[model samples]
Target: MPLTGYTIPRSPTGRSSLVPYPPWHYVGDFLVVEYWADPDKAVTVLPNGLDPHPDAGRCALVFADWQSCSDAGGELLDPSRSQYKECFVVVNALLDGEEVTTCPFIWVDRDFALTRGWLQGFPKKLGSIWVTRTFGLDSPADPGVRAGARFGATCAAYERRVAEATVTLERISETGPTHNDPPIVNVRHFARLEAGRHDEPAVHELARSRSRDRIVSPVWEGVATLSLYGAEHEEHDLLAPVRVGKGFRFTFGYTVDDQEIVKDIRS
Candidate 1:
């Protein structure tokens, strides 16, 4: 009930920064899902933040674990930490068909917001990622069922909410986009749910910090299966991925994704 009425705010490059559900797929007998990932290989501008990933040498998914499920605490604290909303639910989704099999949820956000990450102890730039997000769910350690579900899942739902299409960057070519490196995926990448677990209830967890986080509430709280509540421009600094291409405006590579409706940022 509460999840249905929520609306994504509106404003453009207006950066507030940061922000899944799926079909009958299930995880440990409960949940719903969705996520993003790289669609192609990046030759890699630098290797410090792009060291040899565990999924190296093969086509695998990449995941960004921003916070641990156990550490999520309290209602998420807003910019001022005054207002608060308890967590809603932990979700999972299935991977939509892609040019590649890479899953972005293992280590990334549904919005593709770049956060702190490392290869060794070194930092990483956001440009090095090479995957697109997909959504689905199933029992622990089991690949989620593509269609209907029976039982034994950690959490499951009846519907998978993927966008009209999966977004990808394309080179200016008559055929398609190309990259220098091969795509990789996260073999250990599994859909994790951090949600309310109830139809009309809300919950929040303590989000972990690097060094004794002084936050009164969770920064991210936990993982979620997100859908486009709709685009908004909260802070002017936040920019959409769309830009000019030749004479046509380009954002996502495919027509389906490009037409999903986004808040065009203006200067």
Candidate 2:
């Protein structure tokens, strides 16, 4: 889907966000994510590793999104489900109006018919995931060539050749022959993430209730409103209300009006 809206990252300095975003591409047929950082912000990836991505330094917020690299890439999303929209919404929430470049992405099933399967990763790679941006290929080849690399005895050399080659792919259309060329999907990175507290706990009451099964409950003191999180759920149509009536009053369960006491726990 085309990105229709743009929101400025809510940075006090009006610069970047509290966090930095990193580079990640999907690998399922067309679910691959291939992206780069701004020239100044990006770090060149060495060829020693099979996977390549930029390093997000110390920052509070991180950017994230999924992309479709092939024609079938769009099928994995059930936008009708809450999770899909929530995924983007969550990424946005974490960013808090920070600029995050999420390339439009896609996903396809394991065997969507193409005359070629990426051969370098085949048999073992087939039915698995393959990124459109070849790790070493000068350009991504057709399914035939990618799948053809499977028959060589010097498999390691074949892999290194494929990895070093510049990436290529067909157009990410729903139904079109694999194009001879593919675009370098560029997702913008803004911040680096240092894992820390998203939320914290304030202990209100850590009371012990003695029962055969050991039912221990704690009261949590939250901001402004004291909210409770852990409580037993009753299954049989649990709809009950606080009952009040004449000659009755609401107070602590065991109490005489206007008197409060803190009993010794030793009892």
Candidate 3:
């Protein structure tokens, strides 16, 4: 029989054991906090050949509840494979004279999400994420979408709390959130497995996410607070916010099938 597979642990079936082939569709509700971090510290996390945004060192900490499905849409029926949560930090930077955003750190709760993120150049790891959920009940226990409503979220890994954020909805935004509006840039890096080829990576390049059918819901912006805690193995604290800005809550959807390689380091 001819071998067939798109990813690891291949079987006679071409389907990947982890995640199916794209175009993967996603719908997510997010709580985002925008802030400025130490410019010097922020620059340290950017991949080589990129520079910090000339205006300021801006970063957005995002907590998301996501539902994803492949083109076949079978995963939607199998909820286990389609639902997950994530937390990530995106920093604004300059790539080849153009403004771009890069994800320096990210954590997801599902193995499939983690593997999928790796393929897209996001360095995703396992973490527990919790976000305040809203309900439709007309009672105090259920928070409604309106002024004075507060939302909170937290992310932790290896039993260590990494970050926390709180946002109090003050008003609806007409222009939407600005923190993550730029094109996303990421570095795809995979080291060679052979001991002798340790210095050379199998893949090392700058990539931009190419997502279609993007949609954004009405955004809610308000006062916000964020705190970052340093863990023994995590360096995210280095990007701790120097000045916290507006907080936003929004829902968005998009489809991803491919990426654009901006530069190949090894070429």
Between prediction 2 and prediction 3, which has the larger TM-score? 3
After superposing candidate 1 on the true structure, give the runs of residues whose Cα lies further than 4 Å from its correct spot. 1-57, 62-72, 76-267
Candidate 1 C-alpha lDDT tens digits along 149-176: 1111111112322111122222222422
Per-model tally of clashing residue pairs: 81, 36, 0
For residues 19-103, write the lDDT of model 2, one tens digit per residue: 1121111211111112222322222211111112222210111111212222233333632210110000001001122222211
**Model 2 regions lying over 4 Å from their true place:** 1-28, 31-36, 39-54, 57-142, 145-267
The 10-residue segment with the lowest total lDDT in model 1 = 253-262
In order of appearance, the predictions have TM-scores of 0.18, 0.14, 0.96
Better of 1 and 3 by lDDT: 3
List model 3 lDDT by residue over 179-218, tens digit each.
Answer: 7788999989898989899889999988999999999878
Least accurate stretch of 10 residues (summed lDDT) in model 3? 2-11
Q: What lDDT score goes with residue 31 in model 3?
A: 95
